[model samples]
Target: AQSVSQHNHHVILSEAASLELGCNYSYGGTVNLFWYVQYPGQHLQLLLKYFSGDPLVKGIKGFEAEFIKSKFSFNLRKPSVQWSDTAEYFCAVTAVSASKIIFGSGTRLSIRP
Candidate 1:
């Protein structure tokens, strides 16, 4: 069975601290991975995604993710933290042939200013 897994349920960070959110999948075949974020009062938006070509993809707000095929992991990274970056992050995966998308349990990030 293919599924997405998120290691952190809640995370707290101070301003200027580095952040890393772990995400892994169990699919044996090829898959498209994505990181989506929802701000406190805003709609969910894409942070980054990995489909093909580059293993590393950069997204808005200094966010980046590296896809490691061997580990079935696509971890999100941010060098610095801000209060505005506080949000819930979800990792998603979908197979190229499958229409359904599986989402991991979201991680809530809180930043102290």
Candidate 2:
């Protein structure tokens, strides 16, 4: 079984500040990593994904993540953040042969204006 761990449960930052969220997963075989975000009232949206090719993948809204297979980590980062960026972020993993996705505990990001 695969599981995700989000190191941070809550994060606070001022507008224009940088952000980084740590994520680690447990899986021995091939897997896919993802970052999803949910606004206050919006549905969960896919922020980024790593299927193949480059380990460093760029996502929407200036977000990027690096998939480190050796460390089993897929950390998310943003150079600068806005107040509107406040949301709950989740890191998920699904094995290549599995259909279910295991999600992290989730990190709540609060950006002050």
Candidate 3:
């Protein structure tokens, strides 16, 4: 079974500040990592994902995640954030052969102007 953990429950940052949300998964075999974001009243949107071919995957809205297999980590990063970027971010993981996805608790990002 695969599980995800998001170390930060809530993150408050000003506009243009760099952002990095820690995400770790417990899975030994081949797996896939994903980052999803949900705006205040919007549905969950796929931010980025990592399966193979590349350890570093770039996502929508200037977001990126690096899949460090050695550390079982897939942390999401944004060089600069904006007020509109405020949302709840979730880290998910699923085995290559599995259909069900396990999701983290979620980290709320509050961007202050």
lDDT of each: 0.94, 0.97, 0.96
Task: At residue 20, give the lDDT of candidate 3.
Answer: 97
TM-score of 1: 0.96
Tens digit of per-residue lDDT, candidate 1, span 11-102: 99999999999999998888998999999999989998888989999999999999999999999999998899999999999998789989
Could you give candidate 3's per-residue lDDT for residues 1-113 as a string of tens digits?
Answer: 67899999999999999999999999889998999999999999999999899899999999999999889999999999999999999999999989899999999999999
Clashing pairs in 1: none
- The 10-residue segment of model 2 with minimum total lDDT is 92-101
State how far residue 14 of model 3 sits from its true place (Å). Answer: 0.4
In candidate 2, list every pair of residues with a backbone clash.
none
| Count of backbone clashes, every candidate in sequence | 0, 0, 0
Which is the better candidate, 1 or 3, if ranked by TM-score? 3
What tens-digit string does per-residue lDDT give for candidate 2 at 3-23?
999999999999999899999
What residue pairs clash in candidate 3, if any at all?
none
Q: After superposition, how far is residue 22 of candidate 2 from its true place, in Å?
A: 0.3
Provide the lDDT at 96 for model 1.
Answer: 82
